[model samples]
Target: MVSELCFSDLPAEAGQGWPRGGEMVGITLEVQALQSYSLDPHYAKGLHAWFLSQVEQTHPRLSAYLHDGESEKPFTLSRLMGPFREQGGRQVIPPNTPFQWSITGLNPEVVDWLWGWSQRLPAWLELRGSPLQIRGWKVLFPPRTYSQLLEQAPSSGSCSLSFVSPTSFRHRGHHLPLPVPKNLFHSYLRRWNDFSGLPIEVDLFLDWVDREVTIQRYRLESVKTTAGRQGSVTGFIGCIQLAASPRMPELLRQQVQALLQFAPYCGTGHKTTFGLGQTRLGWLAAERVSTPRASQEEQIAERIQELSTLFLSQRQRQGGSRAEKTAWLWATILARRESGESLEVIAKDLEMPYETVKTYAKLARRATKNYQSV
Candidate 1:
């Protein structure tokens, strides 16, 4: 069945087809698969690269900052949101089905770049060799400045945040899948301090947050998924309701409200660039109410993790960063090959040389055989 597609000019609500005065903005692009295709579980990595390439084509300096800046990324991307069917362990998207993909800018420079680029967006978003036709685009989050965000925040009430995609924080050397209140606010506050130009004393504010902010209600689930090019991540996708103590000063309360409003634009945790932490302002009923099976990406991640564990156990030297890294690389190459991806494609996706990937696959196979023989 052919889906209804929008090919008209930007809607009137979009306001002048660009951001007003280059403020923070989030947009949803209406896209469709040009033909029936089996999408890779880790397609978000390709989408991330494609976006950076687009930025590089015009604003080279901004692209470099977005790519290499040690600071928080000025943007966030959402996984393609639409209908898909699993066929032979892959997500199959039907032709001409409407899909939504969101991109949000955290600062004025990035927002301005988005506005200019949207004027001449390419007809298709190239994902590896498969292409998704760009049908239409609209501003999903209204544009606003950091000061404006703070100034316009509501004076009183609880804030609810919905994490629509897998969201995790880097705590110490590992991924923290649960959204502890302090960590959740820390994520939002870091972005605000970096781009908002209104820096709050981190220790002072977070200490107050720790003592005053409380999770009123929560419904969360943790899932393991593969993202970017390397290791797997364990993250949570759910909704939480939080309230501040009434005894808190009104000034601090307003800042809390502003940061919560900023969550959708800045996202909630690490790897926001690769579609890992898609957040929204209000409670998402679907997340709270429904239970979901492991996604194809999560399933693939599980397989890789299982294989990595087996591979690590066989290694003579089993406890260092290098050993773990090698085990993961071998496991990833083998798992993708078993899933019917070509070696060259796997090499490209992992950013490894073709020869290196081929050697790892051989080594992984030999190791697997030896283990099974015992």
Candidate 2:
């Protein structure tokens, strides 16, 4: 089938529309079905059924991500579940080979923890369509806390303050996941634009999947001080960075959802050849959820009030990098839903997996609960 073919060989028509230096790159990723499943498009006509079937047989570690808008919520799959899992992913994916799905979105803060998550995963993600893993650039970079940790994280308070460079750190790099500094992401973006010779727009997506509604939300200040309820999706963890077009958060959102819908067919063993495919496609646009609004103080206050009642009594926690990120994600999900934005538009803007974004939203429902007593 055309979809199964390596993106390298496209129909003759795909070549006709190309302009000089206007090539599209296909990124391959591995997805683990959160439920039982198949990608044989014809196996089941019902979308939800087919999707549920497709997510079958995930590793024990990965859990179900779904939600219901009810008083006493029980996690269950919804309409966008399957398409977001098995159908919407593009040939595009992460920057390395031997693709890894240990974490969904890009969050500067989670760099250290996510890399650690990648290393510890027992089995590679198992998907149906194309199996691959992102290899090579899998190095973990320094977190916002790295410099501070270097000075104070020592158990014995000894600062072997030798030459403060990556080379010196590498000798002792066993515990230091790839020595990239927090500023590395910034520097990399500049380099990427220069290399592609294409004007790039970046939209960092922030999705919070916290179920419990608490006025006392966690923040950078509440690390150990925060309290989480039983069904609370555990302290509002989120995913960030959706590359798409500027001003179109909806398109990037769709791409994330579609990528997640097609999740059943992608996995670590899924492999691909590294090269840019012709045609600008979606990746050419470069988009992300707007940093303009939520980053503003008054908007943050507005989101807190507009959010579900479960969260009304609690704080979204923007006092620290970790907590502030959670706040942004919650705000974005809520904002998009109330506005009734189109996933296709969201995909066009973010230049990422649309289904993947939906997956994040599905997980968000389960997470953004407004539990009262907890």
Candidate 3:
């Protein structure tokens, strides 16, 4: 059992509505720069086994698969089409540990060591009492992975292991940089700064990070401590699953979008996207598609696919449900072929008034301009 835990005892989750039935598996993805997180319970009630996450701001989405000590690969979990939530079985997490911590009186060398490295996050895993039991590209077999995880997890009442800097995870690998780069990890650093509720006097921040648009704030709260350092520190946290939650699929979608946007900058440290898997690349859609195209039947279909792809590309992003969009599109097509049904008959069939039917068809025809290319 780990002497130092990094989280508090899960508040008596015995009867907490979500399942803990018959030994569950879990993959806790600790996002270093994540500012906020929550999941939809409606999605949770439908998970079978595995849960995946997208890497935020890293290349090829491979970082998520690169666990602290192993190569990239999928975990032994089921893959579902829609919702994806999994039950975290019994395990001990350090108690009263604020997600962010502050460190001072460092050996000066320590500060430099903790800066600029990609493997700064204090994370190590034991799939079976061994520090390197992770799977490869092959399908995994881990009936005991949960128990092994439990054994390795820190105790709620033990010394909590945490980094002093929010970007600590960014400093993995090296002990100290010969000449530490300032503002190098500005993106990851901001997350910890805000989480610690500590004061930041730095002038520079992450690239493209609009300080004018972003808010600056910090607050202190008591948290867990470890023998490796001093007592509890007042700090900050971006997202706590315990604070709020939502479905896995939707959550995954949002993460993928964020990852695609930020991956180029996020330094790699903790691998395997928190040991789950998959590098979801959220794509972007420009406002104009080839300066608008001719409005043909097939063209409409193509336009629908393009817009729908953009909307569904990210999990959380929505545009009327698939069913609704289909119904509306079909109705629109039929309306365009209005010659087949008298407006009055069309209204009766679709269960609307003659005028309403005519109006709908007219509106749909007009909206087509927005959907297609010139």
Model 1 spans > 4 angstroms off: 1-19, 287-295
Q: Candidate 2, residues 298-324: lDDT per residue as tens digits? A: 232244334533332255553444443
lDDT for model 2, please.
Answer: 0.25
Candidate lDDT values, in order: 0.83, 0.25, 0.25
Please give the ranking of all candidate structures by TM-score, highest first, separated by commas: 1, 2, 3
Model 2 stretches astray by more than 4 angstroms: 1-301, 304-319, 370-374
**Each prediction's TM-score against the native?**
0.91, 0.18, 0.18
Query: What would the TM-score be for candidate 1 when compared with the true structure?
Result: 0.91
Runs in model 3 lying further than 4 Å from the true structure: 1-186, 205-365, 369-374
- Residue-wise lDDT of candidate 3 within 1-374, one digit each (tens)? 11211333332221122222212122221212112122211111112101211122332233343223142122222111111123221121222212211111011121222221112232322221212111111101111222232234322211111111111122432112111122222432442233223323345322222221221222212211110100111111121111011222333223222322221122212221221111111111222101111123223334334433433333343544564454343443343243233565444434556676666566555545544644
**Candidate 1 C-alpha lDDT tens digits along 254-336:** 89999988888888889998888888777777733232323666667887888899999998999887888899899888987
